[model samples]
Target: MSCRTVASFISLFLATTAAVQAQTELGNFSNVARGGVATTFVTDFQAIGINPANLGRNDNARVAFTIGEVGVGVGSQALTRTQLRKFIEDSGEELNMAQKQEMARTFTSDNVLNLNVDATPVAFSVVLPMVGSFAFSSRQRVTTHLGLNKNTAELLWLGKDAPIYPANFNPATAPLVSEVLEGTSIQMAAYNEYNLAYGRQVLSLPAFVLSVGAGYRYIQGVGVVDVRSKDGQLEAYSALSPQFNVDYGSVVNNPSFNLQKDTDKLLQPVGRGHGYDVGIAAEVGKKLRLGASVTDIGQMTWEGNLLTANDQKLKRLRSNGADSYEFFSELADIFASGTDSLFQYKPAQERKASLPTKFRAGAGIRVGSRLEVGADVTMPLNDVAGNIPAAFYGVALDVKPLSWIRLSTGVTSGAGYGMGIPVGFAIATKVYELGFGTRDLRGLLSDERPYASVAMGTLRFKIGTVK
Candidate 1:
């Protein structure tokens, strides 16, 4: 393969693990895109995941499907330049002309791609005039994947050469020369959540309309690996030689050919867990709406083994009077002991899957018979240690020039440090409705950024009529 391809592959592999944390945290919140409904009783499937009570508002048996992309462009420049210089020095001699050229080309490609994640909801509801409204809805919660940054290739070059050699190499040297190359990798898997919810509208006094809802959120844990190295490199060769030769000699001489050496550690911890959500929305007047919800109120536990090999070998070599047989025997015992003790367990104490429990209140005003304006403010009540509290404010204008078509434009703030402009259109008839939206135009905000914008489109179909 071309050097650029190699670099791209390495860059992608290493980035896969490093970017997973960001994916797991950011991917869960995009479920809010399914917010619009056709009737004031708006039972759009999207809101069902947010607040089950909204499910009771559905006057019709409906199925909603939404496809969306949530892209983020983020880059960081470190204060140290010497690290880059050192990396060049170490890998300069081993790289062929082809590898050098490929590395250069791969570094320039933009890191942007659509998040390409989607959510769909299918619902059936029945509303008894004076009794209450009940509904059942299921939807895919959230999914995300992130690619690696090309700049990391520069760092990989630093570990390309070392002083030791593996059993697989034939080198001309005095006192035995070996080489080592170290590099970091990132890997991420698709994150998925399944949500099932139930909601009802309760009648109290005539002063206000009260709605209550609860949901079960099932979160699938994700695994990631940040750094990985192959045996062909100089370091792996150097490190394996002494052990390899001793084992080879012992095998040929007698029945006892033990090599009790421990391997280097490269694997990271893997973890998974689940949680729940409950919410309520109330309508005090014709144009006023208020809502509050608590999400991710539980913790997810992560436990897994660390990946590493060869530590025991190094230890054996350093021990006084130690031989190849001793090292092999110890190594066997370590592996035989099982992987349960290698993993360090950590618990997730953050609320709402790191997104935070949010309280929202908004108001809608009728400008004319054909125009309506609305605004909402959402505040996060809990804080995950070391993370900033996120708050979002949004305003939207809907213009209905005809009975079947509606145009919308709005701006959402608090994504990070800037505001995202979301613009879309909705087309509805008695049988079906389709909507499309685009938000977060600050794609050019960072050079090492992953996406230029995030957009979504949704289609809802009326399945049956409910009395």
Candidate 2:
């Protein structure tokens, strides 16, 4: 393809950013609650797929069971839960022009909103005196992004009743813009993974104990959607439904970019692969611990029901409108393509993808019998197709006033966003444990909308024995 085509392709691809089941490499919120500090603080099956060496440190009995664990965190700068309720649940309430205007004012050219979720329905683990420790679990992870541009926002605030696009929108005289406007992306994806971990003591000394281990993981990619653009003639495409509607928006001069997609079917294992995690941990004396690891060094090949979307034809847009909120709203749809459009999509045979490889290290200190503190840092080593998580750093403190009760809180940042205060608690006994927490405590503390936010594992439950 030509340079322009390649540019168009790159812009569109990067704009489409979301996961069907988005989760940071740290995985769930319980992990987040403890500030996602992974170099330490692990003592059970929770260590699997994280730092395998941690498996050998579960001072509990020989076996453990996990009934279920699911977490979700969704935050946005573009809209609030109240606003979303007004739009989706308040059936009797209709949006007024002022409300629409207020909503439109929230979006900008450099904005990002997203959601991440991770879950483990069931799992099991065991420790053998001489054989080390072993465990197995399953997980679902997803990430999604919401984006908006200047032109798209204008369309939603004003209607196409009059020509808003004059040859030269003189900024000095009129409250208008002349440049090719930017657009938004409603991109997403989710996938599943099966993981097995084993840990064994590798070294013993007068003042230190060291362990090493690894995790074998199998991944099944169930869903994917890539749609976006950085520059060129402004345009947008949407398929509201598979068999019905399709919509398109473009400037009068440029080719109308279009897309037709039935992405629902792709939300299954259209691709599969295997990877591994290797790690080592050391206990210095009895109050301090340290660990390091690397993970997801593998690739996946998507061969089933492969497809692509493209808009090559030139087409006419509806009545030219400089600012129409309805037009922009209709322009950014994630599912259900509209009825008519210049964009078209076709099924391809196959594709190859690399896993999101990662490197992490951490350390923890036991301040006393009742309080423990730790810190961890993780970085994505590769730009895996479905995983673009940012490097993260965190520090967490856990307090156990009673054997059956645990409280934790910490500060963390990265994974592509701002800093967060995470806090949560756990109620546990020999037979079961229940815990909850959030990585995006900013959403709870601030009244103004945050740039990026998250909430998950607040309602996590696991009915398993420490024995």
Lowest lDDT block of 10, candidate 2: 1-10
- Point to the candidate with the largest TM-score: 2
Which tens-of-lDDT digit does each residue in 292-364 have in candidate 2?
9887778876654344454342222342322232232343221113222223444345566667788889989
Q: What is the lDDT for 320 in model 2?
A: 30
Q: What TM-score quantifies how close candidate 1 is to the native fold? A: 0.50
lDDT of each: 0.36, 0.57
TM for candidate 2 is 0.72
Q: Looking at candidate 2, what is the lDDT of residue 251?
A: 18
